[model samples]
Target: MELEQFEHTIRKLFNKELLEELDDDYGFTNKSRGSFKTVGYSTNLSLETIESAAENNVELMVTHHDAWDFIYGLKEECLKKLKEYNISHFWIHGPLDFVEFGTCTSLMNVIGIDRVTKYSIYDNGDVPGVGEFNEPIDFNVLVKRMRDELEEPVRMWKNNEKQVKKVGVLTGAGHSSNYIKMALEDGCDTYITGEATLYTIQYAQFAGINLLVGSHTFTEIYGVESLAKKIQELNTAIKIVKLKEDHFELNH
Candidate 1:
């Protein structure tokens, strides 16, 4: 499928005008592709480049971030997009991380840590509710796993000296005292987020739970790719294009 065709279909379905603002708010744009190849570097006015690269027919469209920009809008956009395009759209975002076979679940599985639970407590209603692992692992062990898995050293705010057994898993900056309180309510010994803030750290310390800080992009990398890979296995004709987004740096 031509990239432009898909882009147009997606935009029309989602109402690009409304969706575009959401992307701007989150500073969403292409970040990097990590050695992945693109069809060309030239900029064309039309969707010609995307179409040429995608060829005549693209089967599936995979997005790293939520395409809707907002979940409520997402539902409406999804209904519209699905109806217009023969292409199937799959999104892997916050919920995809915590649920079984989700990103955070994948992370936990890789590390062989059990005793986890996940839920969505993001009161903002913008970010969806995600999983939280109630089981804790040694602080150092969790740290090592974060560093090794992400291929980058992580910065953390250790609110408690105790080992982390119960963990709240909210990928990205869904970090807020509200969710932290939810994790605590769920008996999570630690809270894991993509990023942290001053008040959040204080809340974690006061709540008596460990806080694990990973990059929002770094933490979310797995779920969408994993979903795409799964889609490819099911159908080879479907080309899953993982876009270069999540371009941001840790200020700390």
Candidate 2:
């Protein structure tokens, strides 16, 4: 399918009005592929992900986050590589965070969150991030599920001994004291996010809410994967490949 049609379909799927409201940095960064037979998806536009896309013979690369180092003018090499490989790179950042099958909602589904009962306010609008389980489960059990599903080490700040029924989830760098407070207000006993700061931990402790943290990449990958699946469903002729990377690895 043509890249223009693919991008248009995705924008419609994600809601064009919502994307505009969120001011998302979406659409193609590189437009080398006018038509693509295979597409690649990943959580971020890392060097490894780009290389994997090229290796998999992907003509279009879809990522959740752009190379953030671009702010420091560090993405020239990666951009050059994409141009060299003739791989089109597209990113859908903030819009995917609040979409129906978005980052926060996907994480909630993975961790067994049921009905969404609360929302967290952001620059775009109220995000449906707080929910409840059908039945309360032990905190340790939830931790195990997160580790198994996300395939990342889990960090916990156990502030209460209550079974985790109500939960608030904000994927990818959403662990702020304000979010914790919103969760507490929503009566969520457990709060999950990508990473946490000292102030966030202390706030959760004082507010008596359980805090569970995972790596940013793992927590947000589900959304991009979902997007890829949706795209493939829309265009059966195009193949989709997931470009995986372990951003949490310590070794260079």
Which candidate number maximizes lDDT?
A: 2
TM-score of 2: 0.93
What is the Cα-based TM-score of model 1? 0.58
lDDT by residue (tens digit), candidate 2, 1-252: 997789678766876677777664676678896899999999988778889998999999999998886456646767988999999999998878878788887888777777776543355333438888898889999999999998767888889989998998888887778877777777889889887889988998888999998888888898898888899988999899999687553223
What's the distance in Å from true for residue 84, model 2? 1.1
The C-alpha RMSD in Å for every predicted model, in order, reads 10.2, 2.0
Maximum-TM-score candidate:
2
How does candidate 2 score on lDDT? 0.83
Q: What is the model-wide C-alpha lDDT for candidate 1?
A: 0.52
Cα misplacement distance, residue 18 of candidate 2 (Å): 0.9
Q: What C-alpha lDDT, on a 0 to 100 scale, does residue 54 get in candidate 2?
A: 88
